[model samples]
Target chain A: MKRYLKICMAAMIISGLLLSGCGKKEKQDPDSTSQSGVMKVGMVSDLGGVMDQSFNESAWEGLLRAQNELGIKIGYLESNNNSDYGPNLESLTDAGNSLIWSIGFMMGDAALEAAKANPEQKYGIVDMAYGNNTPPNLISVLFKSEQASFLVGYIAGRMTKTNKVGFIGGIKGFIIDSFDYGFHAGVNYANADVKILRQYVESFSDAAKGKSIANQMYQQGADIVFHASGPVGDGVIEAAKEKSKWAIGVDKDQNSLAPDNVLTSAIKRVDNAIFNIVSDLQKGKFAGGATVVYGLKEGGVDIAPSSDKHVPKEILSEVAELKTKIIRKEIVIPYNAKTYEKFYIAKQ
Target chain B: MSIKAKLTNWSNSAKRYLDNTFVFTLIAIFIGLITGAIILAFAGFNPFESYWAMAVGIFSKPKYIIYTIIKATPIIITGYSVAFAFRTGLFNIGAEGQFIVGGIVAALAGYFLHLPPVIHAMVAFALAVGAAAAWGAAAGYLKARFGVHEVISTIMLNWIALYLSNYLVMSPAVKRAESEATHKILATARIDLFGVWKVSEQGMAWRMENRFFHDLLKPDINIGIIVAILLGVMIFLILKKTTLGYELRAVGFNKDAAENGGINVNRSFMSSMAIAGGLAGAAGALQVLGVSLECVNLSNMEGYGFDGIAVALIGGNTPAGCFLSGLLFGALKYGGGKLQSMMGAPREIISIVIGTILFFTAMPKLIRYFTSRINQKREEK
Candidate 1:
């Protein structure tokens, strides 16, 4: 009887301690009621996590800006796999975030499903093109990344002394396919005789594989290599430095990684798009249920600054003119593999 | 001896079994939970709230419970793979590689085969299991033939399987149109939720009409969990009630003795590894057939095999224990996601807690010391 009583007492004490552990000291008077006017923004990252220095990172920068300038509360969840997209978005919604941003095309299905499930919640996804049947609360934001890739490709085509250049892609998806096709069109536009080699490392984070592939391309007479492989592009720049070749980056300006070897970057302004969307939302102009295309005309995509001394003055001017022509729709560069044939046939 | 003495002897034996593993495991779990609470407190999060949220998160919603079960299905099989190998005195770190091979085979079979509804899914799963068995047996053969440690062979095999799967998935023949995954299998081949036939028009009509039944059963609950639990029971029966299992245990107890006693030790090693591989393959098959619906486009290890090791260790290498431990781990994983959103803590802390649990579970001395102290105090009182 004594032993049983002792055990019961111990159990009671433990439960008491455990229950007290939930004591709240600094919860800020229940977040939703106090911050009625302030907006709550949530961001979901792709498989590359929050710090990939690419699309996810750029989107996070936009969220941070909104928090600092607009006085909005922000939270982010990083996904380790594709399956996490739906759950992460749902979690953010459950947290009562008014607006959510999903980064990358891989999130299209998950975001679409979530948007369908919760028609009242507002969502904006980057790089995912929703045709005509998009949910009323979800907005799809697309970037004409090819417009930027074209300028960099033209530079590569003209700068290659051996008449050979290369392109390295992270994965064989629609977005990467756009970069590849646009680069092909640009190379053909510059010099049809130049050879372009392509390789996919099949991952966004494999820097070593990126370096090896870039090195091999450089060794095989390719003087310039452009990569759309996120962090893998850093390795490409590293290879370019070692081999005295030029490397073109993607998503953002990466010339700082290797100032001398990096020719330019195919810059896609994801941060600008995100900031503009949230800013518009703040101003009571929440543009939902529409596909917003950020193209060259909108300054959504561009070639980063590269010195004329590195790229020939004539080639630079020609590339700049080509960019204007593309913006004007005078030269419609192919954004996908199927459309590339028509462009190629016209060039021939 | 009298009847009382005989009853006491039986109770003593039962107590011995509990002392050997069960008590230690329970104590370990208690310590691990307490440590996790302390860590949460140190991190300025409400430990009770986080744990309560995790518990309620996994059980409060029917969908969450189904999700937990779904998550457990594959790991349960993989845990069995590890547990079965351990019982045979082999460390099967190669479950990961074997699972990948099995997953790839299942994907291929699911895509290419044109059989009827039930037959197609079963055939695909069986083919996957066979392929994974072959992969596992190859490592075992190497260990038997050239004295290569199963550990090294399995690790190397895992890398080979990863690269091989990657190459195959990327090939033009297998690669899906404009996507990283392969083409989705025919509806006939899918092991859909509730064992519902997904192909025939009649089956579709029936399933649509039975929406109430589906809801009652929880539409998200798939056949994988059923298969995992059934396999666990069958494995337990096999180990306890069969001559083959008896021989296998003998080999595990003393390989040289088993060999001298006319049991082929080399054959046991090969067969045990093969069976272990088959279990892992079942996990892979269930994952592709039921969960991801493709090879899942993994750029790195999917972690089921590695998690299996933890499940097996915590389970004390028993079939029934593996099933329960698998569920526990799965609950942690499923609930961890909710905990992160609820408490705003990093999900990595869940992994740390899991690791701490495994650490405590591995140390039987800690449990023995505590239990002995408790017993001494009770006697003194």
Candidate 2:
């Protein structure tokens, strides 16, 4: 009985502390307090969260820049799972954000649904192209990621000493398919004799599987590996570091993660695309119901600036030449298996 | 003297009430909130305002409440799955695998079979549950016959299930064109609430007349919550009243003693796992029919099963306890996003609070020790 009394007192004290801590503030809706007339931009991150240091992080960097330059009130919500996509979009909508950005192709359906539901709410999504069925209030932002992958693949083909290179992907969707086929085309163009080992981790976030696959590829005499698998690329870099091999990073300049082992990164300028969209909206030039494709010609994709540290000057010059060729429509990079077959036949 | 006596009587009764499991959970929750407050203060945010923002985020809109319930629905069922197994002395770590298996089967059934509305959903649910039950029973068989530790086998099975589900989702028959996910389930298989009415013009006109209902029904509001709650009650009753439950509990308590008492311990083990798997599979099926409507090609485990372990632990492995705890977790998750949007607080703050709560809940002995130490000091005084 005495013990129970002691427990009761402890419970009372804790509850008292909690109540007292909250009692000082009146119940105020945070949404109600936002000042009107200032355009607020809200972003909903995919399951990768903002700190993923890959695709999502690049998009966030764009938002941060807009916050600094455009003088717009900016905020973002991180989604923990697929279930959070709808509610996160809804919350951003309820907050009266003038424009909402859904970062990642995974949120394409959710963004479209939310835009249809709230006709007045303007939305922009990255990496998803809804050609004909796009809602009137939503803008689709796409990147020719294959252009950058081909450049990195050319570097890997030129630099490999063991005559073997590898390509690791996250999933087999059309988006990732582009990365795969372009890499194959670039490798074949650079050195037709070099064997290209290909595999998919099937997840954008599984670093362990990525590392193991990279290790196996390295053991099988592949000297350079290129990965487009989001955080899974982190594992590929780690494995490269352990084996003293080389890894080509994706989406961002990932040289900082492994300075010595990273050959280069296939840079997809998600940050630039996002900033461009926000600035366009700010300047009253918002284009909705349109698919905006960013390619090498538009400066949306390129090999990393850090390529000079590992890639030879001659190879870098050759990559530059290829980039110009692609931009000038002199060379058409294949983005899928069928296109790759046609391109391969034409090149032969 | 009369007033003093009355106060003492009231204090004694209050002490008795505080000795309950519910009160203990409340105390842990308060401690968690306090920890979160400290973290918020350190991070340069006003803790009070941040928590208030979270509360408003959840309760300010009817749609938020519906979202919370939707998030809670699967975890609650999964919690019951884990709780049921724990009560029967089995640690069902493969609830994740069972869940994926269930989702895969349900997606196949929902898309391939063209039945009438109610009947289609029922068939999908049945197939999902049965498939998952078989998946769980395989682990049980390995344990019962080969003397394998369930923990090891279930962990391996989890990987198998993940790969298998991914393969199935990507297969031509199920795969949606140019998409990573499978085709969406047929309309007949969907269990969404007011499915036809919500989309129809007449229903829109009616909703316009009723604004509150219009806002409330905006989410994928479905019968998942109702089904979860009914299963919780049913599970509680089965454990308390059924002979099968008695046999399972007896085996869990002492296998040798139960064997001597004419119980088939091996059979009990298999039965417990099958039931647990069925519950988890039902969670997956409901999630497919009521929420996602398609099976996604997973890159990694979705983690509902692992979260169930925490839910069961916090709920003290009881059906009623699981329901309440699952709701608490769901509210925290849905509400935590507001902290990021409104307060600019890192989402990790919410994770820290939940971790602290789970840590405290796991150490009931330490709490009791502190209480006893305080009582000892009082006696000395």
Candidate 3:
């Protein structure tokens, strides 16, 4: 009996060893390697990574498309924690990527550090680029999202049923505030008497705070609200939909998300910028040494017209004429509160 | 002698098996339930729906699963690095910094040195490991030579390592002057995505290994998985068979008793630390060689080292246990991102869940007591 027990235990141990050996080579998708010729594109996911449908996903979609079309290799490292950022970035770079990209503004410091250390290799930073001292080989692709945001705000002001217009902003920062300022401008242009209700969540990704803020705005008689938040804006839309109030979206074409409630979205077109960078790299026309801003003329920023459902056709036609006027330098859209105050003569 | 031996043997085997099946699962579930509730409550999204969303989001697609494994790779490697140290009773809690050391050193080597693929990759790993091991050993030496507490020493070393890596990146020579990350690691040193798919280029010959699983698994997940498995087998072999493993355990269980058994406690502590540090250093090397051929920006907070503590704790500080725990934790991180998108769960929820798990982990005695009481009631019924 004892001998039998020994035999059984030995068998169990042997099987464990065998299975482990098998698991090592079993290759659970990432565990195996296949060499190829295409320039490998690796991404170190920022605070949110690929799953962040708003920012990181935009970049990821572009890279994944590049992988499929160019037959290039693509991989991404998810930053599990803040410290994982460096290692995750290193992991993708080590994996034979000629270009490594980190998605989001938070990646600026890490990207700046890594890109500077490796001069021969090209790098890209999204959102905020180093305006203080630029790198020669690194591409700092920025967007004048405020320009498009201004146009959307004009639309919201025109469309609001109530005289009180609201701006639910995600934090009080230059990039985010641009959205608020532009929306406020649109509302003011549509009606000088439009009462503006503005408040910030102090967070980019907090939907609860966004909902609460939007609810408060609705309670304050804001029949129409515009949000310049990231994924957190989804909550603003949800609150609007629930209250049957109108809302505007920022970053990408989120107008369709709440077709009945969302009047329009100021498109940042992050995906367009990402695709441009990849395409530029492929064509060897990749420009560096300066900040690359994508504005209206460059097709980097605009309002999503096609996605709008409740927006009147005449209003859309008017927006187009207004867009042309702005593009031709006939009507300059003001973004900063100081600038808006200068044009409209508001006290606060 | 026979009866006494039989009783001891039966209880030992039963206890070992019972611990494996019982301890982690019950505690893990309790933590999961609590974490699940938080997701539903905070985000106003239903918890069950969010969890299902996470599960479906990750497991439903082939590409997503591959991504999940790729995500799990570094965690497993870092977990191994920490667990190796735990075995030696050193608790080299500096794996995060070591992971960064591997990355930056490898990036420097990759960007500067031009060499054959094998050589470039090997050198990067070597340098990273060397840096991490040196860092870990310094802490060990301070403790051994000066009787400094390792817990305090390793923590201090972690901070020093963090600043040093960040300072290097911020430096003009090493920093990506225009960007946030270091310049790309040299071409030869990078882990290839095509290599992950096993597809050859238009002109080049199929260079090396058969890698039949390339189509089955992704490539960037390569070397780390191998390291993790090898570590598990090595730990098992060493613990069950080797003199060093026995001595380390003796000291871990009771230092005075281990000394009475004629083991050199100081040497054991020092050597264990050295081995642990070496493993962490090796992890750093892998971070550069096996994944991204670049250095992590140290200025920003990264958690490989800190998480290593949690991984070791959750895995019960066993090599095999850490392997499983790391995989789960890695999956949790990967899935947490999905919960945010699909179910609107907050990114912070993942930390809450892990923290909750760690909380329950501290109460093993409570779990044992609860389970025994339940068993007694069942028997009476």
Candidate 4:
């Protein structure tokens, strides 16, 4: 039994060594290297997968844009669990990708270590700035989704036929709080008499809870609703469809998902920002020393034109004017829908 | 051979592979692959092509291999941490907290210490392990002294550990003030070795100049792998051979019976938690000393603690089994990444696969179908 056990152990060790050995040999092949249009881009998604339809989807869309326009060989590893973060980033670096993108705040540390280990590789981190002060190969893509949410609130305030509007948010972190505040700030700016309801699901994945909250909003006379609940917003759309109510969308142009109910969407433009950064890298214009804030001015955030057949023409024209004002430095839309609306709280 | 000896030989050789966790893990991989393929195919992508692409991406590159092993290190340690608790009849969900606390402590040590790389790394790692073990002992004491349910206490401890870690980073103990994180650890505490991506000009120059690190081994794998594997062997030998190991196993098998037999079950319980926490803390320390290079963030849970439960279960709560399971999980994660990127497989495929394996593994009758089939094969042979 002892001899047999020894042989079994030896076999496993040999196989493990051989498997890892073979894996390493393949990574060293020169055919994988590239420059310019041949440059490769890699991403490590947060806990969510690429089709998360929020941050990951938008990021992948940006990479897809690079793949299409610049002919970059793009790849991404979705992190199913938290422990995989470091390894996922390392694999991308080891694969010799010139640039790697990591979404969400969690990847900040992992991305930093990977960048330190691979100084020649450029990295872009979303949601938060990554790395200590020294690494020159990192870029932070910070978005003022607050700005877009603020503008969308204006549209929601002006377009509400029932005098009541609602906002559904995912997670109550400072970031989401910013989204809430900016949204209410826009709505309050647009209409004083309008009623607004708010609820947070405390999760990015609970679409059912999103729908339930939207249902409550719809029942309480909210005609227009906006959701910044990541994939959970899919539930908001479902609730709208179930009740035949109006909804606003955010992150990506989610209007198409619920065309009958969606009035307009606050576009986060993550795809555009990602593509822009990658394109700059390809053109040797990659800026590493600062945070790039993509707001209304850079066309990094905008409302996707309401393609729905139901949007009132007057509301659309009014939103266009609001957009112009927002872009022209004429309007600095306040963030925080909750607090901004306190003096002018709108409810049934 | 005599009939009795031949029968025993036949059973011994045949029982080995079926009893091994890695073989089951491989079976799980195929099971996961098939399920993933079906779901993916239903979603309009070619399962075969996707799996092939994942294979090419993960295995076709040397970095993927190094990265996978790097990932395997923590899993192995956490697995032993969890498996140790189970062996003493305690369910420890607090490994996550212990890991986080240890990580934060190691991060601090990494930043302040000014020593040689090996010694600096060792001191920082030791502090982390001590913190984790101390934390675990709290729950053990509560359970052993007052008869509190370890399950409930450990669960609560996990939350305490999380909030405590969050506080550490937010407070001056670890806070960088203007920066959310503390300053980067001094260079001595970092794992300076590089396998494929060397940041140091001297390291690269040394490699190019004399092929030093390369002449012996790849840098990315690290010395931690050896520590993890050694622990696996040690755990196996100690549990099978030592008197203390026997007492612990006896307590695990039947606490009341062991207590009646003159073994102090309560003492064993407390010791078990301390040891478990130490292992998890060690895992966290190794990350700073081996991979993270002295950086630890305020993560709610590093996911290793949760996955450690899966490793313990997959390994059937044995040390060697946990090690093998850890490696298996590492492979799944490594391959899963390459799979997602190249084959367009959803990243959630890894979870789906693990979930499926867990579901089946939980049902012995369900497993019996396969093991029985293997037995039939042996009979025919």
Candidate 5:
């Protein structure tokens, strides 16, 4: 038995070594593409995958736009988790993709590392801004989804029958907190007496949790609930349908997901950012070093047009007026609760 | 010799090969690969090219090797956690909870404590492992004292760990100001070897000249890999050589018999679980101080704890087996990105392959049937 075990161990080691030796001889040949003279663009999706019908999907649409109009060849890898980001980026870069786009803030560190490793490989990441000194080969794209959420909050405050609005957030972070605080600020801006309740589902994918939380808020006399929780927001819409209350959508115009129930969506144009960056890269005018802020003024953040035709024209006009003031620097929107508290205190 | 005699001798050799556990494992592996190939063919992909790309992707780049080792380090400990419990006749589904608690404590210790470099890492590690062991022991106590099913309790504890860690991260004292994660671990607490490298122009020039060497020298390759291997060996020695190990195995093989023979079965159960938890806790602490952004910023469980179950299962419930299996899983995970880009395949395909491999490994009846067939041929001859 001892001799047999030794032979087995030796065989295992030999096979393992042989497998690795075979890999070394291959030298990794890059896949050849038929699209001559077209720039190769690679997009790496977050764990939500490309078919998420939200942020990741919208980003893919932008890449599709570049593929069709700008004649760039596009390939996408859907990351399974946070750990996949680095490997996905490296694989895309190794495959001769000159420009790579990584969606979401989760890829911030991975993209930063990849940028440092291959200085010539240009990268664009969504919802991330490197403080001050970003790598010269990377461009961080950020959207003021809070500004759009603020507009939706104003609409909710204007339309609610109970003078109470609710917000369901995905997780606690700067990005998600922006939505929460902006919604609160907007509700108070519209009506200081309006009560704004808040809760977080603590996940981007748990729609059932989102539904239960939304139902609780509706039970507490909140007639309108806005959610910034990716697919989880779908559950909020479902709960709104059950309660016959208004639900605000996010990321894209999700009105079509539940037409009559959705008041409007807080649109963050990930597609536009991706398309614009790829276009710039193609045109030899890529702005790499600087962080790009895509806010309401940039048309990268806006409230989707309401599918409900009966939306009061006066309310629409008022929102448009507020958008102009925001663009003109007359109203500085708060992105966090502390700043919003200052605005609330000053009003008092 | 007659032809029948020669045929009998050949069949006898075949039976000897079939009787070897190592050979049976290799056969299972071969079948698993074939199964993966069949699935890929049905899915309209060339299995050879895809697998080749995966192999090259992981080994062709020096940085990729480091990444694979880094990825394997945590799972290796977690695998041992599950394997150790399995050997003691306990199911440690609570490895996830133990891992999370360990990470939370380590992150807190790393952020709050001030000590010299080596001492800081050691203290943080000890705090994490001790907390995790206590957390795991609670489940063991519930089982021994109240006869509660550990499976149900461990599963419940996983959710508790998740929410508890989430709450801790949100607290003002633990949370970094204006950030989702806790404040970065002090330099003294960092486990990366590159942190201790002396700065010199010669070193800088050498790094810049060779990209591969520069990557190998980066802080990405943490000391956790060495710790993982050492722990694996330690567990192996304890299981194979110690008196306590003999008692633990006896209790595992037959708790009633071991108790009748004057063995402390309850104590064995608690100690085994505590050890398992310690391994899992070490995995969590190493991950936080070594791998993650140097702080715990997990919105959800990282899934390494769950993956350890698969690693232990594939490793055949032994420390050395767990280590090797952990490395295999790590390579598959790190290579999946290449498979996606090169073959236009979903990364989910890697899961299918791993599942198939485990399926084969778990099926003893299949191996028995093959061995019986060879025996029948020998008898006929």
Candidate 6:
């Protein structure tokens, strides 16, 4: 009887905690009937939900802006795992969304399959290009992330007092290789004597690993660290706060995470690209079967506004100059090891 | 009739009803629904409408039902693995590792082997099951030889299997060029029903004429669910009728008694683990051949094996119980996503409801206590 009483008590307490803790609910827009001409845009997020504070967040922000400024009806479905991708896309299609967006490169194959199956529906994917085989109804959004990484590298190169900087990547892949090579090129261009330590967390979500790697680099006399490793950068910033060193953010303005310790962010304007594409759809100018690349010249990437707070005025001016050079094609930023070598020889 | 006599009669009937497992399970399910409704209402959504939408999501189309069944297949098999071990008084926490080992072997065999169409898939399935059985038997061997607790050893093996699979997926020899996953398995290794013919032009033309069959085959319709059901029936028979089953159950009841009665206790442990591991490995093989068709680098455990524990508990460690509970869970999972899509409700609510149900189902003692208390109050009155 005592054991029975204990079990009963435990059940009641667990249910009570759940009720009290989950009372705060998210605000949702009331369901509206789809009008004949009103375009409904639906988005499917990857495993990272809309609040990932990175790529997914930026895409969601863009959708919200479209809802406000363009007066379009917008909805989104968050995926729980890889298997959810196809079904989520199908649900949106069945709901009569005129345009659908798949967030992240991980959803590339799913998006492609969905587009092929439903040729009448227009689809777009972020950070994935199908190259020559892009379907007639799909648009691929690509970012010249290397161009943005170069500007932040310039800042780190100019500001480091220890003449040693570090680069932390999420995974060793084509996407991350661009960030690595671009940072290395920028560092060399600014100060040839400065050394850059590099490491890959091999995972985007492992913050503990990221923090440890950043700590080690700082201990090795690196004054600043730059990371392009999604959520792992949060740990890098925390490490920077602890060590009183500099950390550069990626994807969005993350100065709020560590304020004084964060020098700046390499901002990839996914929101801008998404907003522009939706605006094009509104204007009856859907550019399907094509890959749209956004570089510094296209106003798709830039340094965060918070850069001026930490970076010296002269260094900011130099970064602005470098940005112009990249835009004008006067400086060709390397995005891989082989290209980086050629760029290095040309600099010499 | 006096008031006291009538109250006693009512309490007696209520106690009898609570003693029935089926009725008790229904009551637990009712409590879980109420909990979900309360959460939904507090979260600014109409609970009735949300539940209506979830039901519609599952049953509105044949394809949806097919999809739910597809999702339930692997978990059902894994649940059997857990139930099989539990019946023999062994905790098989290593089902996750065995499942991964099976998947890795299946993917390798599917990709590298070039056999006849039916034979290729069968060979891959055989290799996967054998590998996982070996993986499970290793833990049993340690327990028999060195008196190692299976719970700790299996947990450690789970991590090793995860990292080893990851290493294999990343190796250039197995990795697909320009992708994070392995190469898609060869066409000969696919186990989908009419997979090759379904997408052909002639098949599409035929599908246009047969609307029902088209919708039924819309998802990756495979034989996995059928195989899982057959396996459940087979396990039920084996446990009920076989001499081996008697020995395993005897060991589970009392090892010393079983040993004195001439049963080989050590052999029973190894055989029980091997069979459980084989069931888990079959799940991975079927998933590879029927669903994803290749292995992706897993960031974390997929949780199928973990969910198997819940299924086994809810099932009362019976094969039939696992099958039913697996379907229940699969429907909840696949249908729950519709709440977010249709009504903008958060997905975490589904987890809460499932957790609450599992909690109630697991604590039969609390239900018995409440029933007795009610009887006591009635007698006092």
Best by lDDT: 2
What tens digits encode model 2's per-residue C-alpha lDDT throughout B273-377? 899988999999999999889988777898888878888988989999999999988888778888888788778877786677677666555676776587579
lDDT of 5 by residue, B243-277 (tens): 88888889889999999999998888888888988
Candidate 6's TM-score reads: 0.89
Stretches of candidate 3 exceeding 4 Å from the true structure:
A1-348, B1-27, B34-42, B191-219, B370-381
Show the lowest summed lDDT stretch of 10 residues, model 5 chain A.
A27-36
lDDT of 4 at B144: 90
Quote each prediction's TM-score. Answer: 0.86, 0.88, 0.54, 0.67, 0.87, 0.89
Looking at model 5, residue B26 earns an lDDT score of 63
Per-residue C-alpha lDDT of model 3 across residues B1-381, encoded as one tens digit per residue = 799798768856755654664444544545555565575667676655556656655676564566666666666667766777776666677676666666667678878888898788777767776776677777778887899988888877777777777667656677554334566676677654444233233212232233234223332454666766776777677766999989987888888899999999888877677666666666666666656555644434467667677777777777777777777777777676665444434456656766776666656666557756865795699
lDDT of each: 0.82, 0.86, 0.68, 0.74, 0.81, 0.85
Give the distance in Å from residue A205's predicted Cα in candidate 1 to where it truly belongs. Answer: 5.1
TM-score of chain B of each: 0.87, 0.92, 0.81, 0.83, 0.91, 0.93
State candidate 6's DockQ: 0.20
- Fnat of each prediction, in sequence: 0.22, 0.43, 0.02, 0.17, 0.21, 0.09
Query: Which tens-of-lDDT digit does each residue in B142-165 have in candidate 4?
Result: 999998988889889888887676
Error of 6 at B98 (Å): 2.2
Q: Order the candidates by TM-score, highest first — what do you get?
A: 6, 2, 5, 1, 4, 3
iRMSD, all candidates = 6.1, 3.6, 11.6, 8.2, 6.3, 7.4
Top candidate on DockQ is 2
The local lDDT score (0 to 100) that residue B105 gets in candidate 2 is 94
What is candidate 3's lDDT per residue for A146-236, written digit by digit as tens?
6787777777777777788888876565667567777777777777788999887655556877998998999998887888767678789
**All candidates: DockQ:** 0.25, 0.39, 0.05, 0.15, 0.28, 0.20
Candidate 3 chain B — worst ten consecutive residues by lDDT sum? B202-211
Q: Write the per-residue lDDT of candidate 6 for residues B1-381, one digit (tens) a residue.
A: 999898667656655766887766665765777778788889898876677667768887888888889888888889999999999889999889999988888999999999999899999999999999998998888888888988888889889988899889878799875555778889899899877686666876687678688656567888899889988998988888999988888888888999999998889889988989899999989988988888877778988888888888878789998998899888888778777777778767778867887887776667777767865796799
Candidate 2 lDDT tens digits, A162-219: 9999999987788898899889988888899999999988677678989999999999
Residue B25, model 3: lDDT of 55
